[model samples]
Target: MSLFASFEKLLSSILLPIAEKIDKQVHLSAVKKGMVVLTPILLLGSMAYPLKALKNVFSDSAAVQEWFINNTYLIDLLIKFSLGFIAIYTVIAIAYFLSEGYKIYTVGAIALSLFSYLILTTSVNPDGSLDIRFFDSKGLFTAIFVAIASVEIYRFFTERKLVIRMPEGVPDFVSSSFELITPTAFIAVLFISIRYFVADFTGGLLVPEILMEVLAPVVGSLDNLWVVWFVIMLRLLFWFFGIHSAVLSPILSPIFVQYLSENIAAKTLAEELPHFVTGGTFSAFVNFTGSGVTLGLVIAMMIAKTQRYRKVGQVSLVPSLFGINEPVLFGAPIILNPILFIPFVLGGSLIGIFPLVLMKYGFLAKPFFDPPYLPLFFEGYLTAFDWKTPFVQLVQIMASFCVYYPFFRIMDKQEMIREAEVQAEKEKKSVFSKKDDELLDELGLDF
Candidate 1:
């Protein structure tokens, strides 16, 4: 029992610091900006005649397909469906620039994308006016194919460090098979096959379905304790995707709205006492929580013990409350600290729970206010119910900070150890350099 207790403490200590650093360093803002701008291009490119058949591609839903068999619209839709791949490629190329930097594979990317676009466009109508019945597997294939291309493009530039490692004895071909190139090729081949068979090329087959499915279970089980796990998973995912609140907001808002809302789908929301006044089924609850822009990173700053990190924690506190953690993440350099693991996670957990607690207590009527990243102090109070939500929000923020405080101190100590190591290395180097300097004095090499 004692051993376990000690182990638990040690683990928490290590994790607390690690978590804190991660909270600070995560970056998704740039990705969100790129995605937002890319949406229109993706929509337009997915059509046979981007300008004319664009509307047709969108309208070719199951209802349209059932109603308009053998129609001209279908043909156009297929053309556009494949063409959507070009749009995805273009968007990805642009978004890559927005999110990260440059890629070495531009020559191949440009060549393949242009060819795919030409095939997709010319298939339905050379003049760019096609129909909606074109919604076939090719469309799906094109979209995925393009998306894969763009994602790979975006990831290459945006990747901080290569996290993937080649296994010790794995064959090169087998190892490289799972890499982005092979799977993307497979998707393209599969999509082309589907397009040829179905005639309607714009397919919505796999990736979207996968994305939806992944979100479904987590969104569906709003009341489960596992929801916390869902939230944590989301945070981790955002980290992987480049930590942008904008990207996370759209994904998370619906779930949070569902959590605080009684009315779902066609059903009315369950009635509850008005907390702040807006009361019942607000999306704000989710938004504010994800705005993890606040002192969540400050907690990491606190856990950081080095003089540099301490200055970071102390300095970033004010801005952090306004929901901006980037300053601290970059400034403190806490992207991968192990000790701050505790507070970093708990902070988000508490932020999510803060409104939940209020919603439950009838202190707030409903979580109606959408979470925002700026103006940190007023962040929580923006929720629909009780004024205490703000106070509670404040408390939650403090709790995040507090959780990281001791652990940060421990990490600060660790930073000192690191600095010491650096200094020691420098000193050893200096000794060798000193001898060289002395020899230079005799040799007259000194300037």
Candidate 2:
């Protein structure tokens, strides 16, 4: 009957099924788990970019610069091993996750899947060396395809009992090794054949290159401010309905990571940062203190007169500063709270869109690598490698507060009203209990 009730009913009836589908879908679920597994390594790799910026800043001081220059190699090495071959890691992780679900020997399956991906993407040099250009983020599309395809094929063969079964005395490890041979060979051969066909049909372009060429239009649209904003709005909308918006990460992350890797590569090679939209940019600017940029909302609650608002704000403050806002998300219990809808959705959408305007006008540097879970403005500063970034973030915070203020006022008032009703109910019960005791005493039933 109420507007909030109607909106909630609509979301539950419509969006719930879609959210469930995303969570249960085989490829998507695997991709999500795979990304979660790689998060630590990616965060470590991101540290390299900020340090690289430091190394650049110290160029005027020989001794200081020399110290940084010498130490920079460690960071670069981490980047190369981790983020530099992110696609490879992603494929292996996805394959491992998918294979585990099928009760397959995960390690061997992942290994074969990785090999299959390499076969499709890697090129050979004239001197018999390997060119690993596609091992990095550039190969993301192909990596995903290979990982899923190879894992599915491996699972299919294993499930149908098509592999060699060793006798009872063989070690389990050795038995699995023998069992995987057929499926591995089949998957490898199939991709190798595709590689040959692609080479013949497409003028020698690698699978990654072919994918990049074909998806150029889509990537271009993804880079557009409007399109990026739409996607952000969708994530916020999902969050509003109590769905973990992170389910979409697998689909969006590769595209954003590829762009981010390109910008980092450009920075490393003394070239321009070509991408204006990237994962770091979105993380650092759009969702600065997590979805809804809840830092502003937290501040509003802290200053509100309502007791619950103050308590939730206090509890949420520290975590939100580090870009973790689950405290606020669940504590404020923003999901299905219609009074806070404007702030939850509109505030985030504005925060996400405003940075694009600044970047479009050349007021802010494009983002490079920004590590997750850092304190707020510091992350933004490291991301853009500019002193002005923190200042821009301050402005965004103020703007977000403005957007949240009115909605927060209404929500706070609503909370206070509910608290009043609860207090009145308690007081009424206490008075009734006292009257009953008095009545019992008067009636000589004092027990």
- lDDT winner: 2
What is the per-residue lDDT of model 2 for residues 307-341, given as tens digits with 9 covering 90 to 100?
99899999999888888888888888778878778
In TM-score terms, candidate 1 sits at 0.42
Root-mean-square deviation of each candidate, in angstroms? 16.4, 2.7
- Residue 214: error of model 1 in Å? 18
lDDT of each: 0.45, 0.83
C-alpha lDDT of residue 218 in model 2? 79
Distance from true location, Cα of 375 in model 1, Å: 1.5
What's the lDDT of the predicted structure labeled candidate 2? 0.83
Q: Candidate 1: misplaced stretches above 4 Å?
A: 1-220, 223-229, 237-305, 330-336, 371-373, 427-447
